[model samples]
Each structure stands twice: as structure tokens, then as C-alpha cells.
Target chain A: MVTAVRAWPRPAGRAPAVLGILCTAVGAAFVASLAVGAFPIGIGRIVEILADMAVPGNASGSFDQDAAVLLSIRLPRAVLAVCTGAGLGMAGAVMQGLFRNPLADPAVIGVSSGAALGAAIAIVGVSLLPTAFRVAGGFLLPGAAFTSAVITTALVYRAGRQDGASGMHSMLLAGIAFNAIAFAGVGTLSFIASDEQLRNLSFWSLGSLGQASRDLVMTSSIAAAVGALLLWRLAPALNALALGAAEAAHLGVDVRGLERRAVLLVALVVGALVAATGVISFVGLVAPHIVRLACGPDHRIVLPGAALFGAALMLAADAVARTVAAPAELPVGVLTTAVGAPFFLGLLLRARRASGL
Target chain B: MRGVLLAACLTLAVTHASAAPPARVVSVGGAVTEMVYALGAGTALVGADSTSIHPSEAGRLPRVGYMRQLSAEGVLSLKPALVLATAEAGPPAVLEQIRGAGVRLERLHVRHSPEAVRENIRTIADALGRGTAGDALLQRFDADWRATRTRIAGLPTRPRVLFVMAHGGAPMVGGRDTAADAMLELAGAANAASGITGYKPLTAEAALAAAPDVILVTDQALEAGGIDALLQRPGLALTPAGRAKRVATMDAVLLLGFGPRLPQAVDELATKVRAW
Candidate 1:
């Protein structure tokens, strides 16, 4: 017995203390990201500008420009990073719980690839249509991504189901197939793309947070919040699920319903995130794994903790991405992969070693 | 006696068959279209690819689609007698299909140097059977290029420049063998990213390593992140380029398009490079 990790929901809770620390860390990272840029605005000036904006006409003159820059640009970008990270983290946790495989991620389920294929088709194919039809091309990108994610997930579920039951192995196999098809589609689109279109697609595929508009941030944050809340509700069930499906069933967990809900939740969260920010990889896998190692696999604590940790990680990664090249921003995805690839390899090695493979 | 007569008649027909003016010429690449127009053969043009949007009237011509992903159906529908294309044109299969259809296809060589551009113009003009007009254009262009070169040669020192292609946050710098590199060289400025060949994504470390005195990019790309954002790239802060604040942006098409206006571009670039 793993003692059910009573620290998560005990009368004298330690979860709040952990949450507080994470919040403080996330806040500090946000401030650091804003302050440290090529322009090099001081922390005091940043706060003073922010302070003026909060209370109307507190400070007059040129401070409004600083406030506008911080509020309109950096604030939205930081918020987007946090939301995207939280969404990916929550999706990853849910996926791992549903599949009972620590290796499971949003990418592993083919959601990211599907979204990518959808975006590519929208961007590339729509351009081939007549000029009148081209007016709607902008919406097609995200629309295609969202539609493809939903379709791919539904197909995977259908294909993986055996006697109305889906095992981790079957789901993983289906995901692999989906990813292959999606990638092939993307390749096809790339073949026909113009030099400019190819450049745009390549950049978009690598992922970026530089285009974080206020509307995008708001939509992403809402989607993330909703997804996180849903995951929160499933935490207790997820904990039971870790005990095995049979034991979970005995504990009044409807395994089928839980699986369906978890898959849907993961798909929605991942689809929204990918649609908004392109495919930012590894946050889902890395964040949950870190949280599991730190707090020991208690779903109640792990779910929220993973969300916070993921947000912090993304914020930090984005900050590094923006500041590292100063004027030249590396794609957030590139930075994530540069960090994530090694961590992923280590996870695989650890898993193999533990299994005595 | 009859066999001899038939053979003689066949020989006569073969000898007298003169190549007709391309009744419906379809040009795929923008540079190819410019060359055709410069050769005074725009009257032969029936349709053009999407990028053939220069010379005002070229924009009025029917577009067959993008250069690389050209539709065989769209192109063939134009009923072209000849298709003039660049080496970088098509989805390969489409080009193959057009060739298979027995369309007279001429793939023009993409050139970088002023001399190469002149040679390309001559080759295009000869292909279009307007060699005389082409000779005149070449002479004028060559004179202009030589005069610009002379002005640039008189400069005390050529500044080291980095030509950025596509930049997200980090700069994608042009190196040796690229059109931009050739243009910079022609303008008498040394390319900072000459350590590498062709267009490549420059690592912040590598970018800083080049120690460019002036950062050159297209106007649109500059609009994205601007000077301050470009200067902030991680390892770039330590570079001489970032400190000196030497950044020059020009229109991409004019800077590296290798058209007749290239002399003007070269002269303008020389002026900017020589300023510091």
C-alpha cells in the first residue's frame, strides 16, 4: 500500500503550502521574463508602470507607453505560456492515468500530429482555391486543427476498442497509426507549398509564443481552466485507477466512463492548445513526471501540482527562448525539445532499467 | 527512283522547318517572367505563375498558381507553345507531366552575379529570338553595373554585413553562395556569415561569432521583431553588431531578385554600407 498519500487532503494540509511555493516561483519567473529583455527595462519601472495602469492617472506622462507594452505584449505572452503549459500538463496527467502508462503523452495519442496536419492543409490547400475563397483561409488553419484532433481521437477510440474496451497497448498502436497518417498528410502539403508558405509552415510547426494576441490568450486560458477543472474532478478516480482497473471498479469507478471522459478531456485540452499556439511538445510529459517524482503520484495533489509546475516550466522556457537570442527569439518549441528530448530519453532508460529489460 | 524522290522531299521539309514564335508562352517563376519581359517577348506570354507579379501588366495575366506546386491541368489549359521556368520551379511531377505533354520547356539557370544576370538575359533573349533587343539591354545594364562597381570600389573599407532571410525571433542569416551574399559582395560589403554556405538558421552563438558590423534584412522581416528585438537574441548581446547598432533593411525583391533594377539595388546598398 502507498498509504493513499493522506497529505493531499488531510485536516492539516501540506498541499496548500506546496501550492504557495509554486505560485511564488511562477510569479517571480513572470516578473523576470518582463524585466529582462534586449530593451532592459528595470523591475522598479515595470512595477511602477503596472501600478499606474491599475489605478487610473496615478502617474502621468510617458509611463503609459511602458504600461501598454507590458500589459499588451509581455503580459499576454506570459499568460499564454502559462495556460498552454497548464493545458498540456493536465492533458498528460489524464492520459497517463487513463492508459496506465507513464510514457503516454498528448503527442503519443497523435493529437499534436493531427492538429499539425489540419493546420497545414488549411494554410496550404486553401491557398489553391480561388481568391474569393481565400478570404476564409485564416480561420481554416485552427478550424482544421481542431476538427482533425477530434476526428483522430474518435477514430483511435473506435479502432482501439475491443469488446467495447480499450487497453493501453491497443490505444498506443492506434495513436502510432494516426501519427503516421497525419505526418504523411503534412509532408504532402509541404511538397506543394511555396517558399514563403514552406517557411511559415516550418516556423509554425516548431511552435512559437511570439504571436500571443490578447484574444488568443483569453481563449487558451479559458480552455485550460475548463480542462483543469474537469481533470480536478477526475483526480480521486484517477488515484483509484492507479491501483488497477479491477480495484478501481471495486471502488465504484466506472472504468469505461472514466476512460471516455479522460480521453475527451485530453483531446479537447490538447486540440485547443495546439490550435492556438501550434505544437509545443514535451511540457505534458516532463511536467507530470517531475510532479510525480516530487510529490509521489497522489492524484489530488499531482493534478493541480502538475498544472502549476507545467505553467512555471513553460513560462521559464518561453523567457529563456525570448531573452537567449535577445532580438532573435528561438521558437518556444525548440527550447522545449532541446530540454525535453534528453529528459524523454532518460525516462525511457529509467523505465527499461526498472523493468529489468 | 521513287524512293530517292521521297527521301529528297523529306530532307527538304526537315531543312525548311523554321521554329515558330511561341504562340502561348507560360512563365512559372517571377524572375523568368522578368527576363522574358526584359527580352521584349511579353506579347508571347499567355499565362504566368503567381509570383510573376511585376511590370504592372504581368499582374493582369492569368495566374496558374504558385511556382513550386504548379497544377499540370492549370498550365496545360493555357495551351502554351513554350513554358519558360526556373530551375527551382515545380512539384517535380508537374514539371515531368508538362514535359511529357510535349510542351517546349526551357529551364533557365538562376544566376547571382551581375555578369551571370547579363548572361541569363542573353540566353533568355536568344531562346525567345530577340537577341538584338537583349544585346542592347545587356549593354546598358552592364554599363550601369560597372559604374556602380567603380563607385563602390572607391569606398575606403567594406563593412561586414549579415543578411537575414526569415527571422522569427532568432535571425536566419544568409551565407556564401546565396543571392543575398552575392548582392552584398557586389555592393562591396563582406558577408559576416561567410563561414557557412547557403541560407541557414544561424545559432545565436554562431551569429555572435561572425561579429557583423551591420545587420541587413528585408523591410517586412524588420517590421516583425524590429531592431531592439533583434539585438536581444541570447548570445547576440555580446556581438559587435549588436553594440554598434548597425542595422540596414531593404525590400527583399529589390535586394536579391537579380532583375534589371539590380544596379539600382547594388548602388543603394553600397551607399548604405559605405556610410559607416
Candidate 2:
């Protein structure tokens, strides 16, 4: 269930408090994600491990399983969650603003479907790659996914663009068509794939933080940071564009340029995020809405606020995924969708009630 | 011979802890778990993945999750000195993390062949320091395999068999490059679905055209709907196998696991085919 955007009267005075609360929540979730896991590392022990690792030359000869689990397994996974969540959240806010519509997210630009197609191809064709190429096989899936996502977005943009004005309306339609095509491609691959390949493809689609590594986290963090900073800089432009493209143009905002830049930035950031995390749904579509409901529709606060909130939400979901089944972890994406869909439905109902519709 | 023995010891030392067998072991693959139990090291198993359902006792061990999607923390939580996994067990990084935690990790080079079974048993045996037990198991497996080959060689006809795996959706028939195909080949039978590779949904035309003399299904598949229900499907009902009701069902794991019990599986399937 979804509803069209209603410009909530700006709660300008309360924005700072909301941001502060979100920041604190994110910090808490990060600590919790680090401390709780399948292995029973107590909070005190976690803190001690943290302190031990902080000191120079403390890399002990004795392989401490607790420390390895904390550092190698959970820490990178948590960091990846934060980076991916933040990128998806901010991208969602930007898409909602740029399109002047509430429902627009990266999927509206075919990023998710394109990434899925690319990943399916990689999974099925990986054995065909030369041994030398297969040695770096870990990167191949994400690399292909990212490349295809950008290409899909670019094609959609081209198809949507007409005259000099940004055809945001047609872009949405093109995205829908492309998404179907890409998904069909993925379906065909699944039919032809071996059982193992099918398993890999399904796992990739379900999404997990299990594949997280320091390098993946590092790359995602840089991409998310860049997207957030650049998008945050364009917050004022986005704010103006929110008041109808024609009206914003009259007020000296370059409406066409803003739409182009916003779509490109969202594609780049969300592509990288999806490639790393394997199609985590709901965070991008719902995170910004949650922030806007809390602090009103102000891009400046909504951007950072949504990013922090999304990071917190992802950390909490990932924590549950890691611990709920103990040794058998649930896919983090499944947990997010399970929790997010209901919460989103509730939001839609509340919005309808508030609007007296 | 001394040089070979010396090289073996040196290899073992580098891969495993020096001269001492691991006190506790975690088995990640079903076949790996089977070998561990068959080698008389079952008591040493502290944890196993979800696929390790064979041997009954293995099912009682603490589950570490699916073999392919293992968690490092879960495996480490078992506090095992060694982890024995089939080559298929991983997200790769998880395996590396387990190794980094100073655990001896042995990944068997598995394939759908008897040679691989011998190699896996030998590797698992050496890893568990049960070299004598490994030899005995190998001898028993070889004898059974030789007897099976002899029986199949004496057979007059190689029947056409189809392996239909039905679980909820449209039933998929096993084709070329599948473990089912390998099993059929070993059991003095030709695969009816050899035209296609892997598993594909059984089309009415394909099923009728294959004209199998015997239809093979998993025990679990047969449980879902009886042999009558399977044979009643439109495509299957017209086939020679369906007309005669010559359907054989076997435990899916034992049939496809390609582990120590592979000889038993092949022999059983072949005997059933001959009887039909």
C-alpha cells in the first residue's frame, strides 16, 4: 500500500532534534551489530577486543577465534550495512524529490532489475571464464551488476529524454519496460542454470551481508560517501524542484540539469550498493518516507536524517538475521522486507487517515 | 617408499596440527559427514551443516547452516580444531576466515565419480589420523564396486530410466551432466533425458518421446504423491514405464551423495532395473 506525497507543513524547528535522535540511533545500532552475533562474545569481551586491537603491535600469535569473528566476520558486515543503507536511503530521498513524486526510487530507473540480470549472468557463466580471470571471481558478479545497472539507467534516460526539457514522466515508463525486459533475461538464465548456479542466483537475489569483506566495505563506503556529499550539496536545488518543475524554473533553478544530475547520482550510488549487497529491497523505497513523516518534507534535513535512519534500520535487521537462527543466519534482505513491508503498509494507512481519504 | 611416506607426513604437518589428530571436527558437507562417520570418527564431530542428514547421528550434531552459505561464527562457535568440507562448501571468504582462526580446514576435491570418492575418503582418513580405517573402508568400497560392475557387465539389456524430481512445482527430469545421469550410467541404464543437461521440467512431448522402461523418483518425491500420482501425469501416463508402473524410489541423498555408500546405491538401482 502506498499514497501520493503530501507536503507536510515544514517542522523546521524540530528538524535538528530529529537529526540528533537519528544519529544516536545509528551509533547504537552500529555498536549492537558489532557486539551481538552467532558466537557468544559478551559485550565486555567485545570492548576488550576493541581495546586490544586498538593498541599497536597487539596482533597476538595465538589465533583468538572471538577476535577473528568480531573483526573479520561481523565488523565488515556491519560497516557494509551502514554504507549500503545510507546510500539507498539518500538516493531514495533524492529520487522522491527530483521526480516530485513519492514512489520514485532506483528501480524506477531499472537499476535493481539490471543488477539482477547482470548477477544472474555472472553466476551462470562464471565457470566459462578463464582460470586466470576466475581467480578474482569474487569481484566479477558485483562488477557486472554495477556496469549493467549504469547502462540500463542511461538507456532509460535516453529513451525518456525528449526536446530540451527533462522527460521525468516518460523516464518512469521506460524504466518499467526495461525492468520487465531485464527480469525476463534473469528468468531465462535461471531456467538454463545448473542447480548450483540456480542456488547461487537465488542467494544473490535474496541478499546477504555474509559476503562482506574489508575491500567491499571500503569501496561501498567511498561510493556512498561521495553520493551523499554531492547530493547533500544539491539539497537546495532539490528543494526548489520539489515545488513543481515549471515553478522551480521560474525561481531560477535549472530543473532539467537537476533531474539529470539526481538520476545519474542515484544510479551510481544505488548501483554500487545493490551490486555489493545483492538487491536489498524496501530501504530505498521506505527509508526516506519514514524520515519525511518524522521531520516533514525538507530535503536538507530529510537527506541526512533518512541516511542515518536507514543505517540504523539495516544494522538492527542484520543483527537479528545474524543471531535469530544462531548458526543458520537468515538473509538480511528477507528480514528487511519482512519488517519493512508491514511498517510501510502502516505508514500508508496512517497517511490516508491523516489526509481524511 | 620412505621418501613418499616422509613427504606425506610433511604435507600433513603443514595442513594439520603437527602429529596430533584434531580432537574436535566440524563437517560441512553431507558426503564429508558420511565419510567421517564411516571412518569411525563420528564421536569427534562437534558440528555439521544442514545437508549432513545421513548416518542419522549426523542429524543430531549442532547445525552450522547450509554447506554453501556457512557462517564463520557458527562454525567457530562449535570450537572445532578441524573443519572437513567438500569443495562445494563456501562463500570462499568464510572458509578463509575459518582457516585464519588457526583451524585445520580440509576441502575435498569432489566430483561425480568413484575416483573422487576414494580420494575424499583417503583425505578425510589422513586428516583424522585414521589411515588404517581409511584403508579398510577403501577395500570394502572397492570390493562392492567391483561386484556391482560384474553384475552390470552380466546384464543383457541397459534399460532407459528417467529420474523425475517433483517437489511442489512441475516435475523436473534429470538430464546429462547431472549426478542422476552418472548414477544411471553406473547402474546399467541409459538416461532417458540425456538430450538435455541438468534438470528441466518434464514436457509431455519429451516424457512420451523418451519412452523410458523404468521411472526413477526420489523417496521424498514419491512421498509427496504416490507412484500412481506420478505415473498419472499426462506426459508420464503414456510412457512404457508409466503403463507398466515400473517406478523405483530411493533416498535422494544416498542416490546423489556420491559418498562411501555410492556402491550400495548403484547396486540397489541396478538390481531394481534388472528385476523390472
Model 1 residue A273 CA deviation (Å) reads: 1.0
Best-matching candidate per DockQ: 2
Candidate 2 lDDT, tens digit per residue, B147-226? Answer: 88998889899999999999878999999999999999999899999999999889999999999999999998988999
| Ten-residue region with minimum lDDT total, candidate 1 chain B | B12-21
Model 1: per-residue lDDT, tens digit, A142-260? 67887898788878877776653336668789889989998999988876665456766776687877544466668767887898788778888888888888787766777777877
RMSD of 1: 22.1
| Interface Cα RMSD in Å, per prediction | 20.6, 1.3
- The TM-scores of all predictions, comma-separated, are 0.56, 0.93
Q: What DockQ class does candidate 1 belong to?
A: incorrect
Model 1 chain A: lowest-lDDT 10 consecutive positions: A1-10
- Count: clashes, candidate 2: 0
lDDT of 2: 0.86
The DockQ for candidate 2, computed on C-alphas, is: 0.57
